[model samples]
Target: MLLEKLRAEVLEANLELVRRGLVLYTFGNASGVDREQGLVVIKPSGVDYDDLRPEHMVVTDLNGKIVEGNLNPSSDLDTHTLLYREFPAIGAVVHTHSEYATSWAQAGLDIPALGTTHADYFYGPIPCTEPLTDEAIGGRYVHETGVAIVKRFAGIDPMAVPACLVAGHAPFVWGKTPDDAAHNAVVLEAVARMAIRTVQLNSLAGVSQSLLDRHYFRKHGANATYGQKS
Candidate 1:
């Protein structure tokens, strides 16, 4: 079985999105990349979450060419591929239309770090990309979506933030693995919800930079000490 392990991981990550309520119907996709093999395993396009299987995961190369599986790859395969190609450190990518996160995307607003909950996962505000031009949308849209994300993170480190809202669209997240990517998707939604309520209660209030840095660093990177040692 070619890419058997990667296929299983990708399938589980996709199902995790559904199980966590980050996706409804087929509104999300998760992909795991095998950088050594130059292939990615992703959910099949439009497949029901309950009906998905390990073998149903489609394998494609960095150029988005199907390498295995009978069904078409996720409609966002190019988005995943472009990220993997551009950001070599990321091992997985997840795209979701989760309610709160998508709401922020559609509103064209960033999710500010309003509390410790937001700072624990995201280093600062979750940025929303600028709206895509008609010409870019008309061209290779999925590829353009990836380009938009890359453009938005001009000076931002993807590892520290790990997620972004696509203006007028949805949220895209990534991490060291498929499971990690899915986890970030869940966290993004939760923070987005809290940010909405936080603003409603006090529009001028936000997390102080001192607190944001303390919480973010304590849970992320080599200096992190929030959880048990590996």
Candidate 2:
């Protein structure tokens, strides 16, 4: 019963990515973990959004082995599995090649904490993890991707910063559930767009620390509502 719900949730969330224009063709994927069962539900490899259904979703164990479904799981399955195993608190993962965020990744620069909108979701600049080394990429690129994420945030709180850009790649976001992860993905793209526009308008402008703290506090601190009751 729970697995069924998670499958449906992951399927719908993947569609949300398409609806929000965060992904083109089948360049993105979403996954949700049923920790109780140690299984994950994710979009099938290369499946178009219009054709996706609950059953079309692939089920795999935390070890990334297929448990059920006709098609193979997404290529990012190993990366998702690694994150879930390492961060039990995370229930969902989203990966996307959205134009703006990917642009930042390719530049090998972090997304600055530029506006209140950016600080609402992230307390500081959204970081970009370094590219995986050739040796690590060959050994287990997906696993090493997770390692990169963990190392980048070794002493930091992952919850406080829920999204990251993979250097020379795309952005990946996580949350307590598929919905939250999808929401973060949308927010990430939006903020990335804003940041780029800000730079275009004035290349010398930078996000100030005072603004960042105020915005982060209002939305993330004890009094934070973000217009929604928690």
Candidate 3:
């Protein structure tokens, strides 16, 4: 019961991925971290989303050892843990093979910021990480998966851009909370789909820096004015 609320939030976030068509079958996972407790709550591996429950969420230490739950933790648990450990601002992580976003990942291409929709959620283009080496893939694949993402963000701020594509894999998104991470995943897919079409129409199409800054700042940070104020 230590992470009960966090478990529920992670459960709901997982279901949101299914509801939004970002996940099919059991192809995705969602997790939330309790930084104060140094624990994480995540969906169990291979469990169908329709049957998932708050109690089914597996609790684990940041080192990826399970502390609670009867089921196995998600296969992507290491990726979540590494992100939480390295990026202190991220409280949740979501991995999904949503069509358009995964397509970009498989192609090892970034989703270009073609319009305000892309810029609104992502400060710039959604980056795709470099392909993993055979050594990395043959070893601790999951842990190295996290390392690749962290490397891709070497000079980037995780909060400013909350998502990335793993070459030949899928998309991983994070946020200040589990629900927020799931929301960003949805937006990533939407914009990814749009970007695909935009490029098809005009390969050189791109959003200007001024327009990107305006849309991104208006909805985020201290100066944000897009939604109802808390």
Q: What lDDT is reached at residue 110 by model 2?
A: 87
Residue pairs in clash, model 2: none
* TM-score attained by model 1: 0.98
The TM-scores of all predictions, comma-separated, are 0.98, 0.92, 0.98
Poorest stretch of ten by lDDT in candidate 3: 118-127
The per-residue C-alpha lDDT of model 1 at residue 54 equals 92
For model 2, residues 1-230, the per-residue Cα lDDT tens digits are 33788998999899999999999998999999998889999899998899999988899899998888899889989889988988878889999999999999999888987778898888888889988899998998878888888777776677888988888888989998999999999999999999999989988766688988788877776877568674
Instruction: Answer with 1 or 2, whichever has the higher TM-score.
Output: 1
Better of 1 and 2 by lDDT: 1
Using TM-score, rank the candidates from best to worst.
3, 1, 2
Can you write out model 1's per-residue Cα lDDT over 60-140, one digit (the tens) per residue?
Answer: 899999989899999999999999998889999999999999999999998888989988989988999999999999998
lDDT of 3 by residue, 108-227 (tens): 998888999987889987889999999999999999999999999988899989999999999999999999999999999999998899899999999899999999999988899998
Candidate 1: residue 80 lDDT (0-100): 95
Which candidate achieves the best lDDT against the true structure? Answer: 3
As a whole number from 0 to 100, the lDDT of residue 74 in candidate 2 is 93
Residue pairs in candidate 1 whose N, alpha carbon or C atoms collide under 3 angstroms: none
Cα deviation at 1, candidate 1, in Å, is: 1.7
Model 3, runs deviating above 4 Å = none
